[model samples]
Each structure stands twice: as C-alpha cells, then as structure tokens.
Target: MAVCLQLTTSNSSMCLCQTFTTHLFLPILYSAMFLTGLAGNVLSLWIFMAKISGKSPTHIYLINLGISNLLLCITMPFIAVYYALGTSWSSRSLMCRLAINVLTPVLHTNIGVGMIILAWLALSRCATLVQHSHGPRPSKCIKILPKVFFSRLRQTPFALGVCMGTWAIVATASIPSVVVYSMKETEVVEDGDKQTCYSVAVEVGGSGSQAFAVIGIVIFFLCLLVVLCAYMAVIRHFYRSRKSTVISDRQRVYARVFRNIVVIQIVLVVCLLPYHIYKAIFINLAQTDSGGNGTECHSLSTYVEIKNVLLCLAALRCSTDPIMYFLLDKTFKKHTLNLIRGRSNTQDSHSSRTECGQSAPYNNSSPKGAATHDTHSHSKD
Candidate 1:
C-alpha cells in the first residue's frame, strides 16, 4: 500500500509538471523563439545574398553561416508545435527521430563552421595588418599559406561536403539514442477521471552518447576560447596602432564587425553553459542507482525547467544573427539603399555629369576671368 501510494504521488507530480510545461511555459517560449528565429535567420539570408554576396572571400563564409542558421531556424516551428501539443511527437516516429537527430548535427556543425570562419577572418585581417606594417609589397612566403588553403577550399565543394559530413557525424552519434529509446505508448491518468495518450519511455545513455555530448561541449568551449583570444588580439592591435589608422572608415567597419561577433560569442557562452552543466549532472544522476527517489526527482525537475529556459535563449541566437549582419556590414546597408533607390545606371551617370558640370567652372576659372571663363569652361570641360 505504501509503494502504491508513492507511485501514485510520483505520477501526480509528473502530470502536474507536464501540464505546467506544456500548457503554460512551452507554448509561450516556443512560439516566441520560433517566430524570432525564423524572422532573424530569413532576414540574415536575404541581407547576405542581396547585399554582401560579392564583397569578399570572408563574406562568402559568413553567407554560408547565415544559410545554415536559416535552415536550422526553419526547423523550429515543428519543434514548437510538438511541445505545444503536450510534448507529444504527433508527427511520424521517423520524422521525430530524424528531426531530433538532424538538429543536433546541424547545430554542432553550424557553431564549428562559424567559429572556423571567424578565426580565418581574424587571421586574414591580422596577416593584412602585418603586411601593411612591413610595406606595400607582400613576401612570397606570406602569400603561400592563403593561396594553398583557399585554393584547396575552393576546389572542394565546401557546402555539399559540410552538409554531408555534418549529417553523417550526427547520425552516427545519435544511433545509440535511437536504439536505446523506443517510443512507448503511455496513458496519463489524472484523478482516476482523465486519461490521455502520450509517448514516453526510458532512454539508456550509452558510452557513445556520453562521449558525443562531451566532445560537443569541448568543441563549443574551445571555439569560445579561441574567439575570445582572437578578439583580444584584435583589440590590442587596434589600440597599439596610430590614431589616424584606427579612425579610418575601414578600421571602424571592422571594429563594428568584431564587436558584433564578441556579443554573439558572449550570448553563446551564457546560453549554452547551463544546458551543458545540466546534461553532465543529469547523466551522472541517471547512472546512480540510489533509491532516494524524491530528492533526485525534484532536482531533475528543476534542472529540466532550467534547461528549457536556456534552450530558448540559445535559440534566440539564430534570430539575432541577421540583425548583427545588418548592423555591422556597411556593404549590406549600401546595397539595401541602392535597391530601395532603384536608380538605373543611366540615371546615375546623368546625375554624375550634372554635378560635374556645376563644379567644373568654379574649379577652372581664375579670379580675374571668373565670369567670362565660367560660361566657356562649362561647354569645353
């Protein structure tokens, strides 16, 4: 009878938790995240393609990053809907598994690729600075590394290769979870009066899953550290340089880009830390067989709630990325202005000619011949 009472209480608590999460928190959080991520990522994609498409090699990498984030954001609505419908996978089991599995790899690859690209951009800028300090001429050795790596990168189709490689890694990592956790039909009975179908089951985490999660966390932290280091180097370089060099338009633009990147990195670290810590702790707790269930269960519940909130914050990164691109990239702004203006090449040329005509006389005429030369110079010049 005592065991039965304990089981009943556990069930009640779980039901209450589920109701609170599904009805109250999940709907609001998921909807907001989905909409924000979708709008941000889509805008980022448009801005990159429309404005920064032909700017530089570095912009190519950034455009790809935006594309990856856009793809990930597109998946958010499905996730939101699933949670909003009481955490039940109403979609086909295959889709649920595939979506979950794909999401992990896409996220992992996106961060990895973004960090790698950002590092290259920083390194490229640093190399340019060093070369400029030396002289206008670039040494043969200085040119070799970029030529070799970029040539190789160009030869290999990066987008297709990255997509395939990422999917493979994610699929391989998710295999254990797929095998260990089979969807089981569960009926929640409330007050002996209400019943609803839900998918629930026990998932046994194997060495592989644990290892994958650990490696992912390590990759994330390593990238964060590298980016921080690179930013510090950049800051130092800016400060040490002459004020005139630092205040140039090019330098200012790069500074804004660096600032945005730093903000994004900080957000990434803050949002991901709680999730990683919770995962580590929860995994350890699950492996222990202590029958002191109540305390463990409560702790798990709290961690889960915290994890959900952190996940929402992490999702916000997708939406904010586009805004960063818009704010930081002057080329994007110029392109947008051009598109809005929709002036033809002919019209631009005509305007240029008119402005030149207005200024030509003032430039050509001497003080004594000002009036007389003005009329003649306008026709001749």
Candidate 2:
C-alpha cells in the first residue's frame, strides 16, 4: 500500500513537471536558443568563408565546430515538439524515429568534434607561439615535436583530413545509440497516453543505461583533463617568460591568444558540465530504482526535473560558441564588423546611386550633352 501510494504521488508530480516544462519553459528556451544559435553560426560561417582566405588548423576546427552547432540548432524544434506534445503527438513512427536518430547522433557528434578540435586548437596555438618566441631554448627533440606534428597540421589538406576523421570516428561510435533508440508508448504520465522515444537499452531494466552514463562521464572528464593540461602548459610557458625583462610583441600576441582560449574553454565547461554531471547521477539512481528497489518516487521526480533543466542548459552552448568566436578571435571580429559595415555601405552606395539617377538621369547617360551645354553657355556669356 505504501509503495502504491508513493508511485501514485510520483506519477502526479511527473505529470505536473511535464506539463510545466512542455507548455511554458521549454518552448521559450528552445526558440531563443535556436534563433540565436542560427544567426551566430551563420555569421561565423560567412566570416570563415568570405573574409578569410588562408585557413589555419584552429580556424578549420572552429568552422567545423560552428557547423556542428548549427546542425544541433536545426534539431532543437524537433526536440521541443517531442517534449511539448508528450504522447499526444500524432506524428508517424518514421518521424519519431527520424527525430530521435538525427538528434541523438548530432548531440554526441557535437561534443565529440568539439572536444577533439579544442585539444587540437590548444596544441596548434602553442606550436605557433613556440615557433614565434625568441627566448625559447627547448632541446632539439622537444622543439622538433611541434614542427613535425602540429606544423604539418596547419596545412589545409591535413586539417581537412583531421576534420573528416573526427566525423567518421564520432559517427561510428554514435551508431549504437542511433540503432538502439526507438519510439515506444510509456505510461509515465498517463495511462498509455504518453509516448516516448528512448533507448532500448534503457528499457531493458539492466545496468546498461548506468554503464553508458559512466562511460560518457569518463570520456568527458578525459577530454577535459587533456584540454586543461594543454592550456596549463601554454599558460606556464607564458608565466615563466614574464620573468624576462623584455617581452616581444609576438609574446604579447600569444598572451592575448591564450586569454581567448581560456575564455572559450571556460564557456565550454560552464555550458556542458552541469548537464553531464546531472545526467550521470540521474541515470545511476533511476536505473537502480527501476525494479521496485525501495526508492521513493518523489525523489525520483526531483531527479527527473533536475535532469530536464540541465539538458536545456546544455542547449545553451550552441548559442554561446559564436559569442566565444567574437570575443576571442580578432580576425573573426574584424571580419564580422567589416561584413556588417560593408553591407551597410553597399546599401548606402546603392541607394545614393539610385537617387542620383532618378533625380538627374542625364548625368550618367548624357555626359557629353552636359559638357556641350556647359560649353555653349560659356560661349554665350
């Protein structure tokens, strides 16, 4: 009787939570994120393509990241609809499958590509700084490492290879999730009224979901550790160099670059970490409590609510990444400003030309006649 009562209460809370999230909270959040992310990423793409002729490895990685984020943004409305409609959605099973498969793989792909590219970016930035530094006295082997590895990476073909490899590896790893996820009617908030698209592994009531969550957490931490170490090495190099009496312009430029890289990484962590941490805990507890293992449903409801909110927060990363580009990359900022300025200038020039033609059509079409008229008037005078 106690278990029954607890289950009932949990169900009621779940319904309320779902209603709130689907009706008001998520639509506003998703819409804002989608629009902002789309605009920022589109602008980023334009700058990368039009304003920049030569592409560095870091730039290439950033472009790829922008593309990934744009793809993620494109899927936001589909996700919003899924949550908002609950199980009442009348979409075909194929639409449900397409939405699940496309969204899940893209999310994983975004994370995978971002992590790999960021690590590469740090390495590439450090290599450039070391190459340009005047007071660097590393041993031959140590110095040669960046040249042999990262210098080659700066080449366009090599960067393309890296991007392609990243896509291939991430897609291969994400295939399992794509295959396992299916659309099923779940009785979480209603009597067979609420349909959910979820992983088959999740439905089997085993440790699979928990195991996957642990693996994801481990991968996330591993990449984060790599990024931190790489940036720390860069920072330490600059810090030690500060002891020198005279710092060159090159070193100052490196310092600015390092600051930008640090800010970008900080943004990345702030946007994504909470979601992963909360997800790991939620999966662990939810899986443990799946088989009537003496857990209160109220606590489970709270976990569900927390996880949903965190997931929404994770979506904010897409919007924040372009902001990072604007703040960090001087070239990107300059180009973006120029692009905006150029567009306005073109419009102004076009409007002036149009008005001039309308007001004095003969100025352009009959220059000889105007000159002849002036000559005749001079003769008359």
Candidate 3:
C-alpha cells in the first residue's frame, strides 16, 4: 500500500512539473521577450525614420525588420497574461488562434528578410570593393548600387508590388500552420477539481501538417545558413585584400558597418538555433506519440526551459540593434548628438531670452548648425 501511494504521488509531481514548466515558466519568459522586443523595435523604427531615412536599401530593410519585430512583440504580452493568470488561456478562441497564427509568420519572415538584407549588403560590399580596386574612384561604386536599387525602389507601384510579393510568400508559408493549429478548449481535472479553458493546439491533420511544419522550419534554417555563409565569405575576402586599405572615413565606416552586420547575424543564429532545434525535436516527439511516457515528459520539460532561455537571448536582438546602428552609422550618431545639443542650447537660450528680453541670433554657417539652431528655437517655443 505504501509503495502504491508513493508511485501515485510521484506521478502527480511529474504532472505538476510539466504543467508549471509549460504554462508558468514559458509565459514569464515570453513576457520578458515581449517587453524587450517592443522597446527595442520601437526605438529602431524611430531611429530609422528620424535618422536613417532615404539612406540605403539596407536601411529600408532594417525599417521593415523593425516593424516585424514590433508586431511580434505586441502579441507576446497577451500570451504572457494568459499563462500567468492560470496555466490556461482565458482569451476567446478566435483571439488565441489569431495570435498564434500571426506570430509564426512575423517571426519567420522577419528572420528571412533580415538575413536576405544582410546577404545583399555583403554581396554589395564585395562587388563594390572589387570594382573600386580594379578601376575608377572607389567612392563612385558606393553611389552606384544605391542609385540603381533606389531608382528601382522609387517607382511607387513597383515598390508596392515587390512588398506585396514578399508578403505573399511569407503568408503562403505560414498558412499551413494557421490551418493546422488553432485554439481549442481542453478540460483539466486535478484531484476533485475540474476546469475548462481555451488554448492553442495542433489540429487533427495527418502527416501533411507535420510535413508542412518541417518544411517551414527547414526553409528558415536554410536561409540562416546561407546568410551565415555569405557573411563568412565577405569577411574572408576583406581579410585577404589587405592591400586595398580603407583610406577615407567613408571607407572606414563601411568596413565597420559590415562588421556590425556580421555580429548581428551571429547573434541571431546563436539565439534562434536552439529554439528551432528544440521545437523540431518536440514536434517529432509529439508526432511519434512518445511524449506520454515519464522520460519524454522530462525531456519536454528540459526543452521548454531551453526554449525560454533562447527566447531571452532573442530579445537581446532588439536592444542590440540600436548599438549596431551606433557602431556602424556615424551619421546617425552625429545626428543624435546634434539633436541633443540643440535641445540643450535651446533651453539655455530660452532662459536667457526670458531673463534679458532678447533672443539669440540663429547660426546658419553649416547645414547642421542651421538645423540645430532651428530645432533649438522650436523647442523653446
């Protein structure tokens, strides 16, 4: 009888552990991710608009990436609140389904788009650097790619069509998950207590759904791998061509930007790889019906924990992106500083004017000086 009671207690404990890991711990992890990501992406968006606007194709891509990250972050708080209140989702079924569906595509597309942009940036660097060394002024090549891409990007209808096409691809890739996984209510009975609530779950689709999920995962991984390879090649080529020195500040800035891109790519890989791998394993286990046993339960718990950790790492990307901008884009840093100083000077001038009944002369020597003076006076008003 004592042995029987012990066995029963152990089983209950295991169930509780699994529930807590999935419902409580994972929610908290996602909450942190949401807050961090939202703050970071919003900042990136602002910086892009206010500081980096109309600069380069890379900047345009970065703006899009920021928007995607922001959208994902917005959904995370809902997920966190759902899990925090109880291990159950209290939200409406439709909302749960929409939330889950929206996140997958946003995440998948953001990663893909970001990687593609990085690859383009690297390839552009390689081409421009190679040409500059072989022929006319190196600086001329910097303007050439931007002139070409920007001209193409400027046709409003064409730009819209391109955006639509890219989004269509992402939507197509994500539709399978939306169709196969949806919100459903499940009943949980612990001891004599019973509760029912809605939660996200995979729908009853045979092998087809499983295969589709795998394919989506594979596509993302392939894109990541390709980006990694391209950056590695770029770095190697740069290293080999030591004779082609970065003579000017502009060249130096470009070199630094390339380095930052490499760093960002590395960070993305480190954070995202573990989550995908664990998710792949979890899906495999679920498909095989191997998750019902004790060993599999423990494995699931560990994977959940690992996923939480990865999510935290992924959140770093949002905050880290601003740092990359600061490092890579000297113009952004200068503009930021000018804005700050302009505000400070304006405040000082306002105080002086209030005390002495006279306004300061507007300095219009340099373009930045004129801009700063105007900004300062505007702030005072």
Candidate 4:
C-alpha cells in the first residue's frame, strides 16, 4: 500500500526545494499510515485466513496482497524515524545499515509486488464474474470470453500458483536494481556529510540501474493496462447481458460488479499511476541532460523532492487497501461487522461461502432481494 520517503539533499542554496518536508511531512504521513494500515491489514489477514469458509480464488489472491500491505506497514516506522531525525544517522550505526539494506529492498519489493497483485486480482474478478453470470443466457461471444482471459483463474490451485508466480517475478525484477544502487553506489558519498539514506549515491544509483528502472516502468504500465482492460470488459459484458424490459438478480449482480470495477480502478489510478508515469519522465530527463546528472544534488534541483512526494502518494495505498477490501468484498465486510458488534461468528464462517462464490446463488434470487442488503444478491464469480 505504501513506500520509502527520502529527505531532500543538503544543497538548498542550489535549488528552491524545501529542506523540511522529510522532517515535517514524511514522518507524520508515514506514522498515520503505520497505525491505520497495521490494524487494517492484520484484521483483513485474519478474516481471509481464519474466518472465511469458502476460499475462492479472489480470497486467495487477497491473502497474498494482505501480506504485501502488512510488510509495507512494518517498514513505515523505520522510514518515519529516518525522516523525523532530520534524515541523519551515523553511517556506521546498526539502524543506518538496516535502513539502507533491509528497509529499501523490502519497501520496493512490496510496491512492485502490490501492483502485480492488483492486476491479477482484477483479471481474476473479471473471469469469475463472467463465469458465474446468470442474468440472460450469454451469447456465443460471452461464452468464449472467459477462456480468452483465463478460464482457470477462478480455480483456487491455479490462483495460488499465479499469485506465487507474481511475487517471484516482481521480486526478481526489483532485486538487481536495488543491489546495484545500495551496494555499489551508496557508499561513495561525501566523507563528512551526515547523510545515510538520502544522498546522490542513494538516489542516482548506477547507470545500469536506469535500465532496470526503465524495465520497471514498462512493467508497471503493462499491468495497469491489464487492469483497465479486464475491468472494462466485465462492465461491457454486464451491459450486453442485461435487457431493457426485464431486471433480474443477474442485473443486480452485474450492477454490484460494475460498482466494484469503478472503485478498484479509481484506487489504482489515484494511488499508483502518477508515480510510475513520473518515474519514466525522471529517467528520461536524467538520461538526456548530461549536465543535469542525477549524481549531483545541485544539478537535480527539485526533481528528487518531487520524486519522493509522488512515492509517498504511492505508499498511501497501504492504508487504502484494507478500506477497499472492506468496501469491495462481502465476506470481508460481514466478518468485520461481527467483530465490531462483539458477536462470535464462528458459526457463520463455517456455514457460508466467501464473497468469491462458487455457486449460482444469484440465479434464483427474488427481484425484491435488491431492496435488502442480505448476503444473497447472487454472489460474484
């Protein structure tokens, strides 16, 4: 859900960038995210692993996503501490080493992994919604759509494999760049500076690191495109299946799915897109203008500060993810409410299928079911 924030470099005389955002803003924002994201992710993970009975493909993917969110939350305090202390730590200290070696890698790994997970989740949802559609009998084109995207995305085993694969791929993509930057480059900073985290060595990285960053930007856009297309396809499918003269449980199911698509896409666009887009531009600028090299704080001017601000926005996803899960997943909502109401939901957990439904529960529902928010609105695929 969130990210690593670097302080502005120490050459304020060369540029107009504020010197205090790392001190005044990052610590506060990361602290708020830590408190909120930690509680939300812990609760979500519990519900997904323990409370939900029918572990649909969506729930399986969500479990992995929750793990990423939790990891990001775990890194927040160290980031907050680094910023609040004015971004200074003894270069030889344990905290400084951990910040450089552990925190940076973990934060980045989870951010890439989170984006990949979201893309897969969107595709899975699209597949399941189409597979379970029951409004009007689907046309020939509708019948073939699931196969084109992924027919087995709804299967728990396949979904698990896909999630594991996502983590492996994203983690692999992130490691080389981080290793090059953190090890080969970071130690070459000025001798007397107190900088440990935010320095030319840390920000600029090796020239080869730029190539890897380009790879990352390409991957990010591809994933974003997948999310947009799959969610849009589901929305279009719902439209084609509905009739003007009659409204059925199928239509209601379609309506709910549409609302979900809107919410999920909005979250992706708002939280993640800007950073990836700007990262591409930053890389382009750094490469084309040799005089304005990333290796010098004076040359970079305000670019590094802008980069950190956008990264902070991307990290805001951590807090928003749990809220999104609660709003989007029916099974998640039910368990959370039971906990809030002080009711033991052990009985319900075993009896009901998760929101990622396996049954055609929506097919036979009464039209009046739309008026009530019962768990029986024909659950999604």
The number of the candidate with the highest lDDT is 4
For each predicted model, how many residue pairs clash, with residues at least 3 apart or on different chains? 0, 1, 0, 5
Query: Which 10 consecutive positions of candidate 1 have the poorest summed lDDT?
Result: 1-10
**Can you write out model 4's per-residue Cα lDDT over 331-356, one digit (the tens) per residue?**
67877887898875655654454333
lDDT of each: 0.47, 0.58, 0.48, 0.69
- The Cα error of candidate 1 at residue 85, in Å, is 2.7
> Candidate 4, which ten residues in sequence have the lowest lDDT sum?
372-381
Query: Where in model 4 is the C-alpha error above 4 Å?
Result: 1-18, 90-92, 134-149, 189-196, 288-297, 345-381
Local accuracy of candidate 3 as per-residue lDDT tens digits, 275-350: 6676577566656653344532322445444554565555446555655655554444544455556756555444
TM per prediction: 0.63, 0.75, 0.64, 0.82
Estimate candidate 3's alpha-carbon lDDT, on a 0 to 1 scale: 0.48
Which one wins by TM-score: 2 or 3?
2
- How much is the lDDT of residue 17 in candidate 1? 32
Q: Report the lDDT tens digits of candidate 2 across residue range 301-346.
A: 4455566677778778878888877766555665667566766756
Please give the lDDT score at residue 328 for candidate 4: 73
TM-score of 1: 0.63
Between candidates 2 and 4, the one scoring higher on TM-score is: 4
Error of 4 at 295 (Å): 16
